[model samples]
Target chain A: MLLQASNLTIGYGNHIVQHHLNLVAEVGDLICLTGLNGSGKSTLLRTLAGLQKSLGGHITFRGKDVGKLTNEERAKLFALVLTDNIAVENLTIHDLVAMGRLPYTGWSGNLSANDEKIVKESLAQVNLLHKSESLICEVSDGEKQRGVIAKALAQDTPLVLLDEPTAHLDLPNRIEIMLLLRRLSVHTRKTFILSTHELDLALQMADKIWLMGNDGVQVGVPEDLMLTGKFQETFGSTAFRFDETDGHCKINHLLGTLTVAVTGESPATLWLERALFRCGISVVPNADIVIEAHQGCFRLQNQEVHSIEEVLHHLLC
Target chain B: MNRTYKNGLLFTGLLIVATIVFACDIVFGNVRLPLSALWSDDVLYREIIYNFRLPKALTAVVTGAAISVAGLIMQTLFRNPLAGPYVLGVSSGASLGVAVYLLAGSLLPIAFVQSGWGLVISAVIGAVLVLLMVLGISFRVRQAVSLLIVGIMFGQIAGSLVTILQNNSNPDSLKLFVVWTFGSLSAVSWTYMQVLVPLVVLGLFLTFFIQKSLNGLLLGENYARGLGINIGRTRLLIIISVALLAGTTTAFTGPIAFIGMAVPHLVRGLFRTSDHRITIPGSILCGATLLLLCDLATQLPADGYTLPINAISALVGAPIIIWIILKNK
Candidate 1:
């Protein structure tokens, strides 16, 4: 194991957010830490990353107590990417990434040729080598986050920890970041512990998931946790329900007992069902009210509606 | 414009400018010693050129470099654009320290806050006291903006204290204190230079050692800690270095203004890089050159008397600060 946490309690001051947490992170494992806001995801990450002292219990890296390691030693073992927006001006991606070599570069921090190569390799890993010369202020938010990850990779630690790496990113960019992290974990065999709100993506990509809540912490593979109904127990709410199979949230509005039969499986049919479900109505295989949804149009009860809005209006009125 | 090329050009350009300004500051005064004056045999001219102007010029250079570097560190440490040695109350604290010593010399032994070394000691004590207070508050208040407010409050409180001392002071002591507050480059004779030069050089040398850590700090405290930077130790080191630079300069030259507050922004604008490796040295050079130029502007009227150095610095510095705010906007 690259890292192990046993019987751990994590929190700030006297407030305990989680306790009795036991987990092991092996090399190449991409573990996603998922929890509601204030549920100790950040606190746990901070404790494990050695940014804060653990409230209780033992955390070891390669059989060495984390608390025993010097800061330089811990630095060689773990790299971190934080969610803080960097307000630096005129700092280039190259300089920012090169800073990761601090522990290795001695007091002067003058990067040697080997360190330079590592920086380039890290930036290349994040596909940001082209922008290495560009000032940090010139980059988009996603690119800047990637540049920060590149900095972590340049640290050359055995483990990487990130907090909300996907926050404030567009869908494609969020997927891109996760895929990049997962690929890096596999290719480099580095242990990764990331706390993020990208649940569906985390479920699809993570090797293991650390679920935290008021009830406590649950550690298991995504599928195992899903099968055990832990996801539903942790995330289900009056306004939303967790879909275990797809690992996504669905609106929990109560639908009327009456059902409508939708004719086909297509974009139009999907929209028709979505519209019907949104109006507290469900579509089934058999019902008195039948809708034929085809290319760009919907035929509801023998009347054609040009748009979903019109179809909803006729169906409800 | 490639970043490396731009940094290189700015560095080389600033070096040339600093050297020229250094020479200009030494040569241009009531007695305009030409570049050839160094070779002349007139002893009086040599005395005026070497003993008088040389020390004054060097003091200006050292003062400019020291305070601006301290300002850059404060700006980075607090993650605030407006944060500087002056705004954070380190200078005001130094001012209050000197004011107390000058006004109450009968009460507190004269040997304690005497002249050259005495002022440096008192100023450092004052600056460090304020620094400790700021650091104490900073530990509890995580927000850089809030910490900035605390610094401004410190400045206000220090200013009020200095005003109280001024009111009670005798006219002779009061005039001296008021003149000191106006600030001076000419006041640093060769005797004071012996102390001022080494402290400023040492403070700047220490900066190179912490350059990487300062870069880590630019990412904010938690992230810096994650990178294995001991934030508490680093913060203390920065405060001490700033104190040495700012307090010593304030002691030797009195409360010279604006270089500490404005030069870092001007350097960032000129070089367009936040990397402290570049910014620290860059601010040092630009600060020295700008202060020298401002000193030259002070002597431009050639009235045998001089304009207050603080007024010239503020005239130059205040506009740059406004430009930065507008640019950021």
Candidate 2:
């Protein structure tokens, strides 16, 4: 096990977030902790990363007390990428990433050649080599996020923890970052535990999902979660429906499957299925609305609709 | 360690140069003496050099080095570009002491015979009192903003009282207050230097031990703790260094202006780095050199009556600040 929190009771200044939370993540495992805002998702990540003090219980990493190690030693074991934007102004990407090598450096903060090599490699791994000379403040949001990840990779630690790494990203950027993290975990054999609101994306990619909902905390693979009905319970909410089959979240289907209307000029093959569905009809593989007017739509697979003349003929006959 | 060692070596070189400058400034003043006559201990040259010039030069060198180091520690501890000896109003409180002793005549019984000694003692007391107030406030408020406002308020309160005392002083003592306000380096006797130099050296050595801790502090107090720095003690230690340096310099030199605030700012710009390993020692050298230049320029006896040292510093200091603004823009 790379890290395990033993019944850790965590809180700040009289308010407690969670209690009796126990979980173990192994090497090369990508885990996601998902919950609503203020549901202790970030708190659990902070507790495991040793950034926040555990009020009652303790966290152990590799059978050693996380609290017992010296600060620099713990830094060698785990690196965290918090939600805050990097504070340092005007430092280049290379300079920003090199701070991860500070623990290995001497007290004077000078870097060795090996440390320099690691920093360069980490920057390249983040696909940021071309941007290494640019200032952090000059980069876009996605680039800045990658720069932070590069900083963590520069640490060369076995365990990396991030809080909401994909919170502010758009769709393509979000998938790209999650995939990058997945690739990093596989390539380096390091464990990554990131708290993300992107449950469907995480469910598809992660080795295990540490679900933190109204209940304390649970650890299991996405398939195990489905069999145990934990996946539905964990992400089940008032406004959204979790489609476990396709591993996606969609707006809740109200009266009938919330049908989409197709009204474009061509696309006739797909258009008939869409018109049927728009008028409060469901799409079935071999049962409802037989196919006609097949030129308008191309991608709508197995649904059919009636022509205006057929409706009139049925009424007259 | 090698870099710190090299920095120490550089410090020794600057100390030597400062000592030579001190001797030259003292031995060559307004009155030019025949070499043979001066060497034979001529009455006029001998009195001027021994009684007046030597004390004055020593004060400038020592105060420059001490306050510059203080500014370095202040900037590091607060992680602020503008932190300085006077920004905390540590010197204003000392001025209050000078006001009480010279203008108010409140310590006549204690000073007894030496009129000047009363002012120095009271000034030291006043500065230390303000130091305690700052230290006490720092514990409750960690943000630089609150501490800065608290310091400014302390200075304003002290300044108002000093003005009141100044309005009531007699002519002879009023001259003393006026001279002190303009700031002269000739107030410290050799006896005072014996008391001050060792303390400054000790404080500076202590600073070297915590150089890494100070660097960690640059990240913020929480980050420093995450790096295992004992935050409370480190903060107390910084306060002690600033207080000792500021208190001692203001005690004898009467709050030498511009050097404390401007020297650290100028040094950082010159070095193009913020790492204290270079910044602290660099400030010392730059500060001492600038003050020596200012002190020399103050000797415009070419006009038959020289300008005050503080006036000369303000003249030089203002242009540099304007240049800094222009260059940054």
Candidate 3:
């Protein structure tokens, strides 16, 4: 195992947030940790990174107790990509990434030729080498995040822990970051433990899921966790329901005044049902009002409606 | 790579400017001695050049470099652009010590407290006391800005205490205290430099040793610790170094301001980088040049009367800082 935690308790001061946890991460495993707000995700990541003291138990990496390792030793073992806002002025992307070699560099932090090569390679890995000379403030948010990840990559540690790496990104940027991490884990053969709220992406990409909830942490493969109802148990609520079939947590709509039958090809019907459900209309079989959703139009009671808006107008009116 | 080359050229240019300013400070005092007078056989001219002008010039260079470096360290440690050497009340603490020693002459042995060493010792004690309090509070305060506010509060408390002392002081001592508050670089002779130079050099050396950790801190404390930096130890080192540099300079110069608060910003604007490896040396050189120029302005040939060093520094530094703010904005 690359890392193992047994009977670990994590919290601040005397208050315990989590306890009696046993977790293992093997080489090349992309473990996605998902939890609701205030579920101790950040605390667990901090504890695992050895940045914070665990309340009890031990974390060992490669059979060595992590807490016992010196700071430099631990730095060589774990690299981190934090979600903290870095608004540093005048520091260029290269300068920021070059800092990752500080653990191995001399006291002056003068990067050697080898260290320079690594920094460049890390920047190139993130496709940020083109903007390496640009000041951090001049970069886009997604580019800045990529620079942070490049810094971690330059650190060259076997284990990388990212806390909400996609928190401040748009959808495409979020998917790109997740895909980048997946590719890095596969090619570099390094273990990754990242906490994210992107459940669908996590379900599709992660090798293992550490689902933290009020009851404790449930650890398993994503499909197994979904099949066994762990995701539902953790995330399902009165306002929303976790759809295990598609691995989506959808809002639970109330029963409406009208029940209509929605029939068409898949995907269009799926979206039409969602739209009808959101408008307080229930989709059922053998109803007075029937709607057929197609590629560009919908057939509603033998009238062709060009849009969901017109269909909703006919039904609601 | 290209930026390093440009910075190297900039460092050399600043060095040349500092040297020119240092020479000007030594040569262009009220007496207006020529550059060739150094080799002259006139006893009075030799006395002015070696005894008075040289020490004052050297003091200006040292004071400026030490205080500005302290300011840079504080700004990085607190992560506040407004943080300066005196922001933590070390100067106020030093001033309070001097005020008590000078104003309370009737309560204590006049001869002992009147000595130069006695004043320095008292000021250092006051500074260390405040530094200890600030350091203790730092462990409990997680936010940098909170510590800054606490320091400001401590400064206000010390200032009020000094006011009370002044009200009770005799006229002779009151006059002396007032002059000391105006700040002077000319008061530090070679005897005091023996103590001041080594301490400031030690502080500067300690700063160089932690340059890497200081750069790590640019990313903030959590990210720095993740890079294998010991946050507590780094903080302790920074606080101690600032105390040594700012405290000793304040004790000698009677709380010179503006240079500490402004020089780092000047260097940052000039170099356009916060990388400590460049800023540390850059601050040292730029600070020395700026102060030398300020001191020279104070001593413009005018019937042997000179402006207060504090007034001159503020006059020169405030505009530069304002320019930096507007330009960066």
Candidate 4:
């Protein structure tokens, strides 16, 4: 196992946020952790990164307890890229990324030719090479996010855990960030686990998904998850339904049929549907259709009401 | 990288400026030494330069550098732009310690001779005690506002205690405390300078040596922790450095204001980087220049009178802070 949490209970004070959680992550996997806000996802990641202490169980890295490992030992295993920008008003890109070598550098990074090469390549990897001279406070939101990733890449840990890495980015920036994580997972053969709200994107790139829901947490391949109809049980309520087979969410609204209807064979049928929609009536596309000429409609099955009075009676009924 | 070079250049420029300021400082003080008239064998000139004036200027420069660098470290570590050695109640706490020592001296014969060192040592202890209290409050409160409020409240408490001590003391002791409170470079005699300068040098040397760690601290605690820095340990190092730098200066100069708080921000504004490797050293030079300038201004001695150095610094520092905030807006 690259990193393992065994029977761990993590929380603040006596509150007990997550209890008896067990998980193992292998190298070279793109893992996505998805949940509602305040579901203890970030806390779990912090614990795994050794920033927070577990209440009862232990986190094992390479078969050794994480707490017992030296600081150097922990640094070799994981790098945590936080969501907050840290706002170091004066730090340069190169200098910020070089902070990764602190473990090996002891007191000074003492950048060897090799260290310099690695730092340059890391910036290039994130497409931030041009911003090396830029101060942290001067960069845009997207560039700041890239700068953070570059710092993580410089650390070059086997397992990288990011907390809501895409939380503050725009749509395009979010997709690009996810793709970057995917590439890093493959190119370096490192495991990347990130907690994010971009579920569709997370589902797209993830090798394995950790989905937390009302039905409790589940982890599996994306296809397997979709096949099991977990979304319907989890996110779907009375008002919302995940069209599992169709792969889209739908809302069901109740409104009686309109007296103003048209034949499917005519162009007027489309106009009739639009007219009903404008009147706050949902046009269930495949529902019954009636042709209205001279302000009268009759049911095909019952052969009834050919007048406006009968249609008004039906609406009252 | 450009900013680093810019910082280096600015720092050099400031060094030349500091030298000029120091020369003007030495030349303009109460008994002006004629720069052209003094020879190597001139007895009065030697006495005036070595015994009286030279130590004061050097003390001003070193105190400025030390206190400013210390303030920068405090601001960075706490991640609060408003944070300073004096702001965290250390100065008031140190004052309380001095009050204790001065008050104790009236009842005992040994009090007068040992009182000077006694005030300084107790002041350091008092500052450390308050630092711990602030640290404790910071741990419990995540909001910077609450922590700052607690700091201010703590300062009030220390101030009241020091007041009580001052009122209960003899007339001579009250006079000494009042002088200390006003803040001065002239009161720093050679013997006192011997103790003060070495402490400042040592504190700053240790801070510069840890420049890499300071840079890591710029990246936030989790990012820094991932790089194998023991966050708890680094914070301890910072506190110790702040204590040594602020404590020693407060002990000698009687809580000189604004040097620690203002210099770092001015350096950051000029050099435009948060990286401590340059910022720390840059703040030191800016501090030295400002202090020497203030020292010189205090020595104008119009009609045989001099201004308190603290008054001059507070007048300058308050608006620089207000300006930085407004500019940021």
Candidate 5:
């Protein structure tokens, strides 16, 4: 095991946000922690990374209690990428990443040849070697995040903990970062435990999922958790239903026992049914109201509507 | 250009310029002495050279270096570009100390406030008091922006107290106090230099020890801890160093302005790096040179009168602060 938290309690001051929680992270495992707003995900990550004191219980990394280790020793075992904004100015990417070697370097933080090699390798791993000389302020947000991840990688720790690593990124960038993290775990065997709101991506890529909610914490693989109905139980809402097979959240609409036949083999017909479902209507062959959606037009109840908007207006009227 | 090569060239260039400035400051003052006067048979010229100009120039160098380094630490600790000893009320605290001694001590014997040790002690105590209060508030409020506001409030409080003292002071004492507040390097006699030199040197040495930790802090307190820095200890050390530098310099030469706040920015622009390992030393050298130049500028050679050193620093410093604000935006 890379890290294990047994019966852990975490919170700030006197308030306990999470209690009696147990989690075990194996080597090379990509664990994604998902929770609602203010659900102790960040607090738990901070505690496990040894950046904060746990109120009770023990966190052991490599079979040793975390509280007993000195700060330098803990740093050798864990590296963290937080959501804190980087405020430094005129700092190059190489210089920023070189700071990760503070635990191993001398008091002056002068990087040795081996340390330089490691910095380069980490930058290469993040695919940011080309921008190593660029100032941090000159880089895009996605590139800055990759630089931060590269800094964490340069620490040479066994486990890396990141909070909202894909928070502000677009879809392509978000997917790219997830793939990069997965690849790093597979190729370098470094364990990653990150908290994120990207459920579909988390479900697709994570080796383990830790879900936190009002019912306490649930830990399992994505498929097992979905099969056991724990995912829906933890994150279910009155407005939506969790699609178990497709791993998606869809609007929950009452069909009202009234259905309209949806005709035509094109994608327009499928979208017509979707619009109808959104309005609490369903598709059936024997219903009085029938709609046929061809290329740019909709035929509803013998009335030809040129657009989906017009079709919905005509059917509802 | 390679950053290392650029840093090396800039460091060497600063050293050369500081040396030239030091010599020029000693040579050209209110009384322009010839460079060959030391080797001449004139005993008065020798006395002025050894006892007056040399000490004054050295005082400027030491005070400049200390205050600039203090300002650099303040900028990093608060993560505010405008943070400095003067702007943060540390110097105002020193000024309040001097005000109390000069204005309130009027009821006592003349010898009480005139002693060099008395002034230095009172000023150090005052600066340390304000430093402790600021540190206390910073400990409670983790927000840098709020801490900055608190510092400015402290400055205002100290400034108002000094104003009250000035209003209540006698005319003779008020005139003396006004001149003192204007700042001067020539007032630092040989006796003060003995104390000032070692204190400034020690403060600069302490800066070297914390440079790496200061680099870790560039991101913020949380990230610094992740890199194994004891944030509380670092903060304490920084406060102590700033107090020593600012308090001692203000005590010896009065509250010299702008050198502390502007030199670090100048060094960063010159070196093009935010790493403190370079900036700390860079600020020290750049500070020494800039203040030496300012000292030279204060001497009205043609009119045989000197402008207030405080005025020159503000003239030089205020624009730099404005530029930094605009650049950051």
Candidate 6:
């Protein structure tokens, strides 16, 4: 057991956001904390990072009470990559990552050769070594995020906690960050606990999911939680349905006045059904007007159309 | 390696400039004395050099270094570019103390109230009182910006109190109070330098101990804490150090302006890095040099009349700050 928390309650003064939480993270486990907005994902992460005081219960890291440890001791045990944007001017990526060695450095924060090697290695791990001399403000947001992750890596802690590491990133950048974290966790054998709203990616990638719901925190393997309908129970609404097989929360379209049958190749048909759903034309097995969607063109009533717009125009007209 | 070499050159150049300015400030006063006059047998020149010019020049150097370093710490602690030594109302508090003593001290029958030490003691006590209040508020407020706002409010309240005291003062005392507000490096005699030098030295020394903490704080409080810094303790030490440096300087020099607020920005621009290790010493040297130059400018007319050091600092420092802003933009 790397970290364990039993009967933990976390909140601001006089207002409890979460309670009766029993959570455990083993060595090398990528635990993804997921929840609705204001469901205490960040609060829990902060409490676990020892940045905030837990209202009740105890958090033990390596069988020792975390609250009893000194800040320097805790810093060696776990590092954090915060969500807050670092807008500090004139700080280079290398300089920012070098600060992670401060705990082990001298009073003046002069990095030793060994510390420099570690900082360089950390930057390389995040693929930011090439841009090490770039000022923080001069870099792209993805590069800045990588620089922050590099800083956390240079801390050389056994556990890394990230609060919404994927937030504010586009799709490819988000996937790249997640993949990098996963790779680091596997290669370094270090535990990572991150809170994120990316349910699809979290469900596919995380070793375990800590779903913070209305009742309490439900901890389980991602597949097990999905198979047991816990994801549906927690996140299912009138507007969307959680797909158990694909591990996706898909929007539930209302039945429309017009019905049309979508046919042909799977991926194309899938988008055609979506377009029909959006245009208030429900997809059915049989209809007077049938549309067959190929890769590039749509065959609607034996008349070929080049785009979904033409198909929608034929159906609506 | 290249950056370090450049910084070394910058420090060396600044030291040379500061030395030249210090010598100029000492030699080119109201009664312009030649370099050979220091070794002359003339009793009047010796008296002027040792008793008046040397102490005043030293006071300007110490005042510049102390207040500029205080401003740098406050800027980092509050993470506000505009933050300065007096941002926490320490100067205004000292001003209020002097106002009450000079304008209202006649009501008290004590003999000590009329002495120079009475004014210094009162100013320090007033500054500390405000510091204690600000420190108390800091513990309750989580954000540095909030503490900054509270400090500004404290300054406003203290300024209002000082104005009220001035309105009711006698003309003789009013003239004295107004002259004190004009600020003078020459007013600090050798006796005051004994106290001022050590306090400023101690404050600057304390800053070296927190050099890493100040750098960590530049990333903001949460990140600093994650890096194993105790934010509350760092803030307390920084606040105390600022109070000591700014409060003591204001007490002796009567609240010299612009040097504290403007010097750190100049040093930061020159260094092109926020690393406290560089900026701390850089600020000390740059601040001392800037004030020395300003003080020398006040004596440049070579007339017997001297301009207020406060006015000279503003006139000289403001344009440099404006240039830095425009260059950075």
Q: Write out the backbone clash pairs for model 4.
A: A90-B273, A90-B274
Model 3 over residues B1-329: C-alpha lDDT tens digits? 67879999999999999999998888898888889886888999889988999999999999999999999999998888878899889989998998888898667776887678878888898888898999999999877778899999999999999999999889998998888888999999899999999999999999999999999999998889899998888999999999989999888988877888799998887898899999999999988998899998898758588999998898988888788789878
- By DockQ: ranked, best first: 3, 5, 6, 1, 4, 2
lDDT of 6 by residue, B1-329 (tens): 88889999999999999998888888898997999886888999999999998998898899999999999999899887778899999989998998999899888667887678988888898898899999999999999999999999999999999999989988998898888888889878888888999999999999999999999998888888889888999999999899889999998888877788788888877887888999999999988988888888888775898888888988987787788678778
Instruction: Encode model 4's per-residue lDDT on A134-155: one tens digit a residue.
Output: 8777888878888888878888
Instruction: Order the numbered candidates by TM-score, best leading.
Output: 6, 3, 5, 1, 4, 2
Q: Which regions of candidate 3 are displaced past 4 Å?
A: A263-268, A293-295, A301-303, B140-143
lDDT-best of 4 and 5: 5
Write the residue-wise lDDT of candidate 2 on A1-317 in tens digits: 87878888887758888888888989999998887677798888777766668887778888999988877787788877778555442346876677677667776666788988999999999899999877776788898889889888988889988888998889998999999999999999989999988877987888998887776877789878766777668667777756657766655433365333333345553545444544444546554324334443322325333463342233233
What's candidate 3's DockQ score? 0.72
Q: Give a tens-digit lDDT track for model 5, residues A215-272.
A: 4799999889888988778877788877877888888887766678888767898788
- The list of candidate 6 runs beyond 4 A from truth reads B38-41
Give candidate 4's error at residue B290 in angstroms.
1.4
Q: For residues B134-218, write the lDDT of model 4, one tens digit per residue.
A: 8776767744456667877888999999888877888998897887788878767888888888888888888877777777777
Candidate 5's displacement at residue A245, Å, is: 1.7
- Tens-place lDDT digits, model 1, residues B155-258: 89999998998888899878867877888898888877888899889999888889888988888987787777878778777877887888788877777777
Question: How many Å off is the CA of B123 in candidate 4?
Answer: 3.0
Model 3 docking tier (incorrect/acceptable/medium/high): medium
lDDT of 1 at B163: 92
lDDT for residue B183 in candidate 1, whole number 0-100: 89
Which numbered prediction scores highest in lDDT against the true structure? 3
lDDT per residue for candidate 1 within A1-317, as digits (tens), equals 88999999998889888888898999889999998888889889989988878889999888989999888888889999987888788888998898788888777667899999999999999999999988888899899999999999999999999999999999989999999999998899998899998888988999999998786888899999988888888876788877756767888768988688889559888877888888998878889988887777788777887888997788777
The TM-score measured for candidate 6 stands at 0.97
